[model samples]
Target chain A: MISSIGRFIIGVFSSTGGVVILFLRTLYWVFIGPFQKKPVKLESVFYQMGFTGLRSVLIVFFVAIFTGIVLAMQTAYQLEKMGAVLYVASLVAISLCRELSPVLTALVVAGRVGSAISAELGTMKVTEQIEALEIMAINPVRFLVVPRFLALFFMLPCLTILGNLSGILGGFLVGVGSLNINPYLYLQTSFKYLELKDIYTGLTKSFVFAILIALVACFEGLNTTKGAEGVGRATTRTVVISFILIILADCVLTSIFYFSNM
Target chain B: MQRDYSQEAIISVRGVSKEFDGRKIIDNVSFDIYCGETFVIMGCSGSGKSTLLRLMTGAIKPTEGSIIIKGKDISKLRTYQLDELRKSFGMLFQYSALLDSLTVEDNVALPLREHTKLDEEIIKIIVKMKLSLVGLRGFEKYYPSQISGGMRKRVGLARAIALDPDIVFYDEPTSGLDPVVGGVIDKLIKDLSEKLLITSIVVTHDMQSVFRIADRVAMVHKGKLIQVGTPQEIKNSENPYIKQFINGLPQGPIDFFKEDIGILEEFI
Candidate 1:
């Protein structure tokens, strides 16, 4: 029994170590891969951007808007008791920019894009397509992982910015239409409480969260064993692990910004 | 044009062994494959024929001993060096391994595009030529999922031979095919080795494919080479395992039981 527990702990540590090595290798390729004789494909970068970013816009937008409404309505319900219902705008904006937009967007992307990445690469690994790539002398990391890393890194920030804006708009609609608050006063109050620092920190979190999702997904996918069942497991692990890591990272970054007053 | 199989060995494996989870898959195997010959490795399921092929191709490292390919010790080479050495090699996977996202032409064109500076026109011509070689001439725009299994295998062959490699490895070339389709593939393998003068290493359990295409055959039984000879010699082999395998017998040295389940227990 003790041996089994020891094996389990060793497995977890080794898996984590493998992921860190994969992450560092991917980062190295992302910077130096372009200078190689056969550079990483520019077209693949754009293709991943389309798949992971553009296709995700509508879903992210809708989720953000609804989250904003829920936040405003729930907070208004309480603020009314204190006769501070007009403060709903500041609450919604600050919450969206500081936490909801980045975290929720990452969670959604981790579910959609992260799982897709894992499934695709896992299928390739199982079917020997990755071996085929290696036999052809192409580095599968540069050929497969780098484009994905770049796509998420660049596009997640853009998605977060859009999500934040859509969320604020949703707050505006709920504040004026449902709560009967002044539109101009709500807008003024929203901007007054939401500073550039909030936007910067949120975008920064989104960027890091993007790297986390891509790295975890690619690592799980590349290390997939067995067959179809393994691919399914990898996809699930990508979403679950990405969610936990993103949330943990968000806590650390939020604390840093809080303590440093950035 | 006829070719000779008595040339110097192109690949030499010496006392190689591979283990997975302490289970021996390949054990102290040794052989030499000469240049410009279709060398077939024949074995029953779980005999490690596929694993041996992977080791030869440098896709997997052996646990002990050495595999020398074109005079370089494959196990000792760095990752990039192995990759550089792989430029001379091409492989057709058992399932074809065609990228589902790419069209037939693009799949065939991938290695050329990545490894060479040929003009797009030249690349298109070369892709067309390879497709023509594999009898996939007109299916260039179709995806892998859109093709029949035999056609997909041919497309895989086209992709594998796209770079005019000096050596090609075929893993179970006719495992899942009908007899007629398998015959066509067997004929293609023979013709390609002759026409291109490219060394061929085929891993299969198919007796007909071994007889039809192999200039030399290596019979593996439970991770050991029982015999290495021409097809006629293998057919004449008196070894019990070889006879059992080749004759398709129900009972012999090759046990059917996966585990030690008792006969009475199995029936119960």
Candidate 2:
């Protein structure tokens, strides 16, 4: 049992190391490889942006809007006891910007886009398409991973912003139409309570989540073994690991922001 | 068109051995493949023939010795250097390894677009010419999944020759095809080697393909080079493993199931 535990620990460390190396290589290709005469294909990056970002909008909107409505109703239930039910607008706005929308959008993208990336690359790895790329002297990392990394790096923040607006809109509808709060007052309360720091802090968290999702997905993908079974395993592992890492990273970033009074 | 002994060796494998988890997949194997000739490495499954092909392709490094391709020691070349060297070589995988996301024309045009600065028109023309050479005309817009297995293999051949590589490596080029398609591929391989005068290194277990396409044949059994000779010479070889492998005899010195027979006896 002790030896098996030890083996597990070693495996985790080794794979973590692999992920770090892959992340750095991707960063190099994205930032430095272009100047070295091998530019990342712009069309491919745009294609990935469409797949990972545009296609994910509807799911993010639904998740964020529902969460927003739930938050407003729950907060109104509490604040109504103190005759401060109008604070529901402020509560929903602050919470969505500072925490909910970014995290929820990330989880959604991690499920949709992250799993797809792993499955696609894992299939390619097992099928020798990756090896074929390498034999052709096209670095698979540059050809496959960099555009994905760039897409998530830029698009996840945009999705989080979209989610933020959608969620705020949901809260507005609940506050003005159902809760009998004045529409103008609800808007004012939301704006008054939502700080620039809150919005930026949330966006920052999303950027970090984007990195985590892209790296975890691509790392698991390129390291996939066996065959069809391995592809399935890698896909599952990408989703699981991305979810864990996004949450863990959110915790660390939130604690830092709270301590620094951001 | 025959085996050219006068030409210099273009690819040299010297005392190469590959190990995985302390298990030798390829023993100290050494051979040289002459320029512009068809050399086939024939072996049963799991005999390290595919691994040998990968080693030559620089996909994996050998644990010992070196692979020298076209006068450059491939094992010592850096990534940039390796990429530069690889531009001159093309490989056809067992499954063709065409990018599923790309169309047939794009697959053939990939190496050209990546490695050359040709215009779109020029690249399209080149793609058309290469596809025609492989007899895969009018399939340019189809994805890999939409094509038949034989057609996919031909497209793969078209893609492999897109860059007009000096040498082409084929890993089990005729493994899963019907005999007619296999024969067609064999003819294509022979024709490409002769017409293009490109060195062709093929790894396969099919005896028919070996006799049909190989100017020289190397027999590998259990990670070792059993014999390397002309097709006629290999057919007439007296080596037990080679004879057993070629004759498909169950009872020979080349038995692979010796390690687990007691388990079968126990079950029986």
Which candidate comes out best when scored by TM-score? 2
Once fitted onto the true fold, the runs of candidate 2 whose alpha carbons sit more than 4 angstroms away are: B258-268
Per residue, candidate 1 scores C-alpha lDDT tens digits across B87-152 of: 889899999999888999999999999989999999999999998888878898999999999999
Displacement of residue A228 (Cα, Å) in model 1 is 1.2
DockQ of all predictions against the true structure, Cα-based:
0.85, 0.91
Give model 1's TM-score versus the native structure: 0.97
Candidate 2 per-residue lDDT, tens place, A54-122, comes to 999999999999998888989988999999988998899889999999999999999999999999999
For model 2, residues B92-151, the per-residue Cα lDDT tens digits are 989999999999999999999998999999999999999999898899999999999999
Fold similarity of candidate 2's chain A to the true chain A, as a TM-score: 0.99
Give the candidate number with the greatest DockQ.
2
| Candidate 2: Cα lDDT at B264 | 90
Return the clash pairs for model 1, or none.
none
Instruction: In angstroms, give how far residue A163 of model 1 lies from its true place.
Output: 0.8
